[model samples]
Target: MPAVVVTNHGGDVPDFEGKITIYVIICVFIAAFGGLMFGYDIGISGGVTSMDDFLKKFFMNVYEKKKHVHENNYCKYNDALLQLFTSSLYIAALLASFVASRLCTKMGRKPTMQIASIFFMVGVGLQAGGINIVMIVCGRIMLGIGVGFANQAVPLFLSELAPAKMRGALNICFQLFITIGILAAGIINYFTSKVHPHGWRISLGLAIVPAVILLIGSFAICETPTSLIERKNLDEGKATLKKIRGTEDVIPEFESIVAASEMARQVKNPFSKLMKPSSRPPLIIAILLQVFQQFTGINAIMFYAPVLFQTVGFGSNASLLSTVITGLVNVFSTLVSIYTVDWAGRRILLLEACVQMFLTQTVVGLILLIDLKTTGSLNHVEAVIVVVLVCIFVMGFAWSWGPLGWLIPSETFPLETRTAGFAFAVSSNMLFTFIIAQAFLSMLCHMRAGIFFFFAAWILVMGLFTLFFVPETKGVPIDSMVEKVWKQHWFWKRYMVDADDEEIKEQVHPHVK
Candidate 1:
């Protein structure tokens, strides 16, 4: 038998049986495939748009504009329809999350993920084979709906299944897989760009691989004991809890989950309860983190790195290669987060990254503002410098805001409002992601190099927000965050007092220390 490990966070939260079991590892890696699908789309979309063959076939006007030797460096890829191809999925994701939240609540996280995979596979087919703009855009919309479901379910699934002691490292696997997917897309797009007239097809078609993996993987992993227990499958839930914990003595943990689920069943409407005082801390923090994550302009850079390289004077192949370098940086830096997030804690990494990103963003802005002219591109040396600086910025983001943005919210919400509150977080992320993906090229056209400073300013604000508003959530059990984290937070605690606490107090020993 595997050794039973019990860790206590000052006795404020429950100590449950936890071990690094192979069964749990396999389940998490499988669920994390959803992130791979998402990341591939993000990384591939920009590179595909930059492909000559891809543009010539679907967006001829933009392709012609790119061929002009005298085109303004900042405005070459500023077509609205082209931006729509990249951003339409996010808008779809935003709307689909509400429906996904319902499905996650009524069905289970596993089913929602399976649904997401099916939708993404269809999207991959439509996008790869699309001859018309309508087919491509419609495919993107389907992909968006799929992303909506996956994003809504995956993080919450990981958090619920993960041991509180190992939660940060495990939950972050979703982001780690996302970074790997981005890296894979970059490598594929680099080789595929060499193929004439159909390379983009291959890039878009490959999205189906991860989608298929996620679909098959979803069936193999057990439904989270939290979800199963909440859905009233008590016997299986306990058996699962025992298996995942690597121990037969899971009575305490199982009973705790059951108690929480019973309280959740009392609340007929979680969204309504989510607006009440007790829910404010998680709701506010979750939404703001998502909005701020996008405003950091991480997605802006990820979505258009290749285009930005081209604007800065790298040739087509060189631009694609540079994007690949940054993709590599993004993937490796995320590994740092996985190893250190549990040990080093969340705020320190986040604060350190804000400073690093601020300096890099500002320096890149200055370099572009000085060397990159409106009518002409940066010189070769300066262009190389710009890519290096952007790599530094990407490193800071991939390790810090990128993973924690999802990790924090997924762990913060109480069971009664967990899925519903997480839906709000997902919608907020998708909404801002859409805004950034859609407007970034036009914003570049208008703001020129000043766009970097704009994002840098937002990074500064994110640092301040983290300093004061965000509470440390290192070892608190997901089930006890209300009592152990939010209610204890200096600024957030005021929102904790209300009828909800008293009601929970009266009913059971759950929801508080």
Candidate 2:
């Protein structure tokens, strides 16, 4: 007989074993289309906004400002409406995430992703066919809602389906696909920028590709076994668990899930339960990760990559090309995370990235502060150096904050509050992303090169936060996270009530009095 492994939480903590079955692989890849769709919009908007034709059609004032030889290098593209085009999606995403949380717990992750795709495709149609700014912004709002739904569901879905041993790697696929989508958009933006009057339209229309893929994939994949079991579909959940685990002998795993679901049933309102002392650690960490992740100023750089490149001295074509290079770096660095996350543990990567990102951002800021000014651009060599520095910063973020921001929160919450808690995570990310996206250009206009220092300081805080508060969760099983992780952490442990834990232990692993 196989060894019956147990955890700090006893019988409910047994790690479910599973092969890396083809079915699971396909499902992971499909669900990750949500990330692809999100990244596409992020990359596309930046490049599209920089296009002359695009600006002429939708933002003529910014386009005219770009032509003036005397325009402040830092302030050329800081129009409110131009910023709105990129940022409106995130505010909409923020509102949608709460609704998405309801769908994730009540309707299922599979259906939530399907709904996301439908809305995203419609958004794509509107932006591509936009006759005026109103149509485009409305489309962006639609896209935001789609993003909110997808971001909320996909990470939780991946974590639930994956085995503990391989969870990090599988879950990182969502971020991997996101990086790939950004790279794809960068490439699309490059060629289409040459297509004249309607090139921007082509760029905007192609957002439909990833959305369509997600819509189709949603139909193909099954609802997660955990979701099904939680909803009281025991037989179907059992069948899915067998399929996903690639085994008929799943008795221990099924019992563990059923027991957890039984406990989940006792908590009628998951959000209210999140307020209890036991739930505070994950909730606090989840929101702060999203906040720090945004404050890293990664999106400010990403959302205006082409515009930023131009501000430093690159011509239009060269700026788009530079954005593509950074996109490549982002995608490849995320792969580094995929390989190392399960091995290095979360804290190591995150802490190491903090130092790297801090130094790079600081140096970049200092360089621009000294060499470039509000009136003129960087010298060609200096401009190249800035691009290289930005690439390093992107690399640091991609491998650490980018993926872990999603991965950690998804894994930390117990099944009882998983979707609801993750919704807060999703909305937190969207809320700050909206703030950064909306205000970044204006901040850039005022802060000039000092903006980089602002982010570097935040990176320092991120490192300190991770060093003291974040616990390593390299291979912990999902069901026993509170006991093995939160209950063991030096700080979080204080908030954990042993009596409540004892009660749960008694239920999952009963003993004769």
Candidate 3:
């Protein structure tokens, strides 16, 4: 039998004590800068495309009214057009993540990010200067390729590098930065929208500056030590791990990786192995989590926050201001998750967040229905409630799905299969994000108040799925968990039957040297 290898299996929090070096933190932060770019790119487009008055000067006025005010409180035909512009990037991301995953696996993480940054810089530059809508779409497609690559590579790099104890918290920094970027974009658009009719150009153009920064920053980051070992460069891999952890006792740690890599080699082509029968459960779980994460309607809110606020009767600036608040709430609450993840455990936190979201979403739907029925504008009370519920939903998402969805898949699979599994999961996520994101404006335009109910139903289903299916993976080390997952029954089922079982706990968390 192959030796039983344990990875990341040190005792609670203490094992990571000295490993949290400032240099390591800097590396994590840099890898997570891609999240900033992801947020900036996605969030800026929503408000930027609404620069209809400015865009009209360059192209034909697709709508009769300026973006500020319209006859029926909608932008007419151009509303759909602007939404398409914002969402097409997601469609491009859907395709690009698959390509990125394969390429990153071969090229190594840092180089992959460097290549991605080049795409982002070139793409966003083209977007800002594009004369026609089609040109902008092409630029977004290019931007999506870069974003897709970074989105796949960054969180995986950060999660794998983060010490086990601080892993969840550190990895979640990506999600927090994502919200910060969103809030920053919202604030930037709010202030700049009135300054120039072509304000969206500034917002779109700003992304390139960060892309340039990322291109430079990528060189300083150490490639993931795990990848080094997989390439059979053990000595350098040991040195890299020591540099990352700043520790001398890396040889004990090195043994686990060697055994794990050997197991990985046995399962070598991840895509091919996933096609076999044994991979079904993990594959299903991976795909389902990705789908559910997107279907929860988070993207709908983030992608069209200003419009959603407008639909609820807020003024243009007020709608944008509300978006800022939404972003702030998302950022802060994700911090709460960062602190609590190791303490409360993944499954519990996710369950609570989902329930809170379910209640809040249902209430929002009912309020919208009542307003539509009464022909009444949302009074101060209703508006406040709507804003609060939106914040609540943002909080729930930031804590649970936003980061955890990215973090968990990185932890769940063995090294050989991880990239492929994560690639598929991300691709599935982008696919759904594309579908929901592109159709959201059209759905809201056609369905009006009923869209909330549609999302409510989806959120409800997701909560039940979590209650029954999603496993609790708090404090579990990555290496042993892989072996235990193969030997033990599914974690959720085992936990459900015997929550206090000692053996399960030990297997989930074996002692590390």
Candidate 4:
């Protein structure tokens, strides 16, 4: 017999059975395959560009022909072009996210994800078989567009479908798979780097496997209940709610969705409404979190770990191995957040992780600075310390911003403005990511040890921001607007105090649990 569970709103539901939980987990995992594609696309280029064969064939061919440069100069020119190539995807992603915001609302989440997967597959096909630089750049843009769509859709889809109790953990599937994808790419790069001209091709083409799986799997999942309700298909929404919840009594949840949708419909302009004083806190928090996540320099670390390791006196094989270790630490540490996010809450974890990252980044910078001042290169012990600090820094990020960056924005906005809100947040993320990716190698060239110091300072500022501004949203209902949810906080108390005491009392009481 299935156990019965009750909601705070005086409604009963069937406790989820093991089989139903498995089904939901499978669906979430499939959607998260997009994260794997994102990771592979990101991780592949670092290793491929580093390959002598790949550079000589694709980049050095043009430069050497025009300028007749030496091998060393050719390598330097190749590195610069690689950075542009890497960042081009993110540039495309920024534009795609804006389009995705409208398309997701118009087409529904499932269909939107399918479209992204198709783009991913097409992009991978072109990249894997490309004969020229122009073809490769075009492919990267397509993949970026796919990534932009997945970035917005996957988290929102999971948040809407997950049970309230499991929402945080379920949504984090996106970040977890991203780490997994990175790890897989790192391992592939390690082996493929030993091969000749074809190794880079194999590393890139492998992304197609996951893209195909995601494209097919997208069709099997039900449309989100909230999206269905928003479309005025109330009956189908109720059915999806029941299917996802594995319970017959979905009226309480269904009515809550209807009410939230009605409230959202009342707003005339979402972008304008988001700017009003009442809604500004959540919007600001969402955007700043994304900005800080990229500024942490995590992507720079992940995408160029091999190069950074080489700069610090490691050989090519050692650098590649070290990168794989970073990927493993990233994947395992994220499980900590998955287990504890609901229990530990978002605010504290983010704060503590930021502090840890700040310390690690500072230590890494100091070590490099000392090496430059004294030995002119790292000794074995100093090299070990640098490796340890990098691993710890990645761990801190994995357990905090990497997952929370996606989770908070998806949960922060009201139903009506959610599409636009999340789109803006995700696009903000891509914009910063593009800046960091494009500028990182240049910073390394110009600043050297100073680059780490820059990141450490940013981490400190992010920590302060988290301490003062970010509100606790541990178990808040997804449909509740920020104004309603954070009315008791200092920012909203003055504005909301006299607006609707009776309604506030009723709204606040039921979600108190």
Candidate 5:
């Protein structure tokens, strides 16, 4: 038998046992499949749109019919239409995320995740079989809705279920799966694109496999104890907590959860409370971090990497291959975040990543701009340089903003406003994702290298934002985050108070002080 472990939660409670750790890990993996599906849908479209057969089936006629009038105009118009097709999912996802907030609260986390899986299955079916633009559009919308629900609910589910010490790494696991999904889609696209006429269908349909896995896995995972308690099922909540913690001495944790839920219930209007003076700081932090994450040009690079590579002198096959490299770098680099997030802290990683990203984006823009101004085409060396710069930029993102952006909001809000706060934060992310996805190609068409410069400027702004405002949430207990961190009047002063420091804790809570 394994030795009983203990936690310091004001009393001696058994620490998570081996069996419970296994159960929690299994649940997290199942929930994270939602992220895998999210990445597959996002990455699949990029490759699918690049496929010759896909283009011929959907876009060739438009180009052919209008080619006589002006070839460039027709091509531009078709590109715009394609952009709209790609962005449709994001728009639907934004709307679905808000709905998921209510659904997750009402139905509980497990059921809400199952709902997303169902949407993903239907959406993947339509897209795979889609013969017309209308069918594809409808499919994208369904997938978008699924993405929204999964994005909002998965992180929240993982956070609630995970222990504070491992919470950052587990939440980052959500992003890790996303990168894996992207890499998988890229590999699938690379192979399928070689098959010609029906390859795009295979790429689009492959997403269904993960969606099916998620649907089945959803049945096995337990409901979050916090959600159960909030619904007033105290007995069931305690039972679930025992299962999750793998120990019968779950009284302390259960009582803590009950207290938090009761406090949340006291606030009749969570939304209005969110807008109050006391709640504004954390809410602002959540919203702005999400905004900066999107505005940093990560999605633009993700969605159109193949096309961007082709523009800089690579052939279609090579462009697709290069996209695989981007996906690989993304996956490997996120590992850095998973390992360091707990050790190095959030604020430092984010600040450093922003600086590196700023430099990389600037270098990419300068190289592209100089190429346009001088040779009008990149030499082999310059092309390599551009690719190298892009890889570095992606590395900076994978370890920092990419994971922290999701992790922070999940940690910031009090339980009272957590669901609503997450809804708003995720909706913000999706909304910007839509704007960036819709605008990327058009901006590239007109601005060329200037688009990279635009991204560089935003990255600089993000670095400053981090330096001044973003709090370091290394080992802070979730229960005390709102009272200790968010309610602090000064940004610099926020870090002065540590949740674990008894003296500092006393200062924050006057009665204790």
Candidate 6:
């Protein structure tokens, strides 16, 4: 049997034996639905964009009866405005993530998720029937708020509640569900866009059903034990731990919770704390990982695949169909990551993904920049090359960076600062996402293939950074894993050690500092 080590608050670790619990998996699945929301929100807008012609036609009729408001009035309400229709959801998420770091801490995880679901349902409902852009933005914001809450809260909650052995796998489930959501949206859009005459509206409205289902699911769960301890409800906290831990002694677990909370309370300014010299390494890693994840060009592809295909000489329907294929590649690759993450480890997968992505994107950039030079036509071979590169890039991301980015931060963070740590990471992610989404359309217009080159360079940097700096985290227990990382000497060592060195056993477990 695998050895189990347990520790109480501010105490030396103790040993125990048990199997991983079902409750942890249950929580991961429920919370990961929030990722589904993220994916749905991200992809559903593309389908909505598909209906721009229909919308213009429908609104044109109304505008004609109103005596022609302006010659190009609806032109002002074209793709850019429709892009905002989807982009606003993420904008809302960016704001909500900041608020959530504070709110989730005070309100506790279960209640907060319930509240988010309510907002999600409300937002999706309003958005589907929204007559004006104003109403649409409002609905988008509602869903955004829920998404923001889930993004920060769910991963943080899952990390804290899960067993050390399974934390990485559990946390990656969030990303896995995101891929699943993207796939679902793509498939649904593909079928519905043909079957339903008003397909895009139906796609936008489908988000409401999932939100309602998640809301109902929340009632069957209990508050995280950590939150109970944070509130000084020791008896309830202990009982909750026992319920989850099952036959395992509760005192040590309860004590560990109290100790971590006490230690976290001392840090006061979580953001400021991250900037201190001692804390800077992890913060940089967290921030850079988020930056690279965005610049790896995943979202850019997802957001504008159809436009890209059209620009590369494909019809509108063909472009959408191609996007569905890309989404499938993404979903399957993510499932591969879910199966391999704990087995292959985070750092290895990250490095491998970055390298492969760099090569594929380089080919793609060259093909776009040189092969089609000064010509408006793309040859069949060149088109196939672009599709293959895009597929490979998506595969690399799905199996590595996509899931591991979310997993590593959850593992690296100390409990006291986990929420705040994730907040910074998530905020950094949003900042980059915002930058890319806002400017990518313009960049495609002006720079075109140059954008792929820019992202390829980012991937190259990400690959080198991961190779040198990112430590192997697979199978490492969270508390001990954190302690070990902090104990590393950044100053010149007498001799360099091998990259694959096994972590010192003593450094694998940590208590509340």
lDDT winner among the candidates?
Answer: 1
What's the lDDT of the predicted structure labeled candidate 4? Answer: 0.80
Pick the winner on lDDT between candidates 5 and 6.
5
State the lDDT of candidate 1 residue by residue for 1-513, as single tens digits: 466466766565668878878999999999999999999999999999999999998889999999988888899899999999999999999999999999999999999999999999999899999999999999999999999999999999999999888899999999999999998999999999999879999999999999999998887899999999999999999999988989888898899899999989988899998988878889999999999899888999899989999999898999999999999999999999999998799999999999999999999999988888877788888988899999999999999999999999999998999999999999999999999999999999999989999999999999999999998888777788878887778988887787456676866965553
Cand. 2 TM to true fold: 0.95
lDDT of 5 by residue, 318-347 (tens): 878988999999999999999999779999
Worst 10 residues of 2 by lDDT: 1-10
Error of 5 at 96 (Å): 0.9
- TM-score, per-candidate, Cα-based: 0.97, 0.95, 0.89, 0.90, 0.90, 0.86
TM match of model 5 to true structure: 0.90
What does candidate 3 score in Cα RMSD to the true structure?
Answer: 6.5
lDDT per model vs. reference: 0.92, 0.91, 0.74, 0.80, 0.82, 0.71
Model 6 stretches astray by more than 4 angstroms: 1-18, 52-80, 195-197, 373-377, 489-513
**Going through the candidates in order, what is the number of backbone clashes in each?**
0, 0, 0, 0, 1, 6
After TM-score superposition, what is the CA distance of residue 323 in candidate 2 from its true location, in Å?
0.7
Tens digits of per-residue lDDT for model 4, 226-300: 999988889999988887777787777788889887876666577776765656666788899889999998998
Location of the lowest summed lDDT over 10 successive residues in candidate 3: 1-10
Per-residue alpha-carbon lDDT of candidate 3 for residues 135-243, written as tens digits (9 for 90 to 100): 8888988888888888888877887776666678888888888888898889998887786666778888888866887888888889887777877888888888888
Model 2 whole-model lDDT (C-alpha atoms): 0.91
After superposing candidate 4 on the true structure, give the runs of residues whose Cα lies further than 4 Å from its correct spot: 1-20, 61-79, 373-376, 481-484, 492-513
Deviation in Å, model 4, residue 496 alpha carbon:
5.0
